[model samples]
Target: MKVVIQRVKEGKVKVNGETVGKIEKGIVVLVGFEKGDIPSFLEKMADKIVNLRIFEDSEGKMNLSLKDIKGELLLVPNFTLAADCKKGRRPSFQSSENPEIAKNMFDKFVEICRKQIPVETGIFGAEMEVYILNDGPVTFILDSRELFQGGLS
Candidate 1:
């Protein structure tokens, strides 16, 4: 599993010109699942995300977690994040999980995330437009392989 986490003052997702998910004062999480990705990794990733000290404290230091700020979360499925683009002009989808499996994993990820904060989500396998008001322009990428082995360094 991989996630691109962005701190945002607000975010929303639209499908077929209709708003499907929206959030205020939170993070916009673009999530992807690869072959062999599991629910345990999703759980760990959620814990890491909500607890990450990416938000700034009163002293202007990045010392507060999402839990500390009582923030919301907007999760979106993005299979392209797992695309293999090393050799060819066209990206390869071999690393991406099958749609059915990926959707299931995505749902599990959302479920884990909702336990910690208010959660919003984009529809799986849908063509969506995402709008974000990024806070501090702060962003981070997380991979389960790296995070679970030791630290998210």
Candidate 2:
């Protein structure tokens, strides 16, 4: 599992010109499932995200968490995060999980996140136009493989 987390003032997802999901004062999470991803990563990642101290506090330090601020969350499925572009001119999605399985995983992830904060989600496998007003342009990437293997601290 891989996730790109962006702190945003607001974010929305539109499908066929119709808004599907929207959020204000929160983070936009672009999540991807790789071939070896398991269900356990969902809960861990959700906890990490909601508790992550990315928002600013009264002292102008990044000391507040989404939970502390009562912020919302926008979750978007993005299999391309698994793209392997190290060799060829074209990016390869060979590591991406099977769509059917990944969709289930995505739904489960959303459920887990929703339990912690107000959550919105882009339709999986749908063509979406995502609009984001990034807050401080702050962003971070989390990969389950690295996270579980002590590669990220």
**Pairs of residues clashing in candidate 1:** none
Candidate lDDT (C-alpha), each? 0.92, 0.95
TM-score of each: 0.96, 0.97
Candidate 1 lDDT over residue span 32-93, tens digit each = 99998867797789989999999998999999999999999999999999999999799999
Clashes of 2: 0
lDDT of 2 at 68: 98
RMSD of each: 1.4, 1.4
- Model 2 scores a TM of 0.97
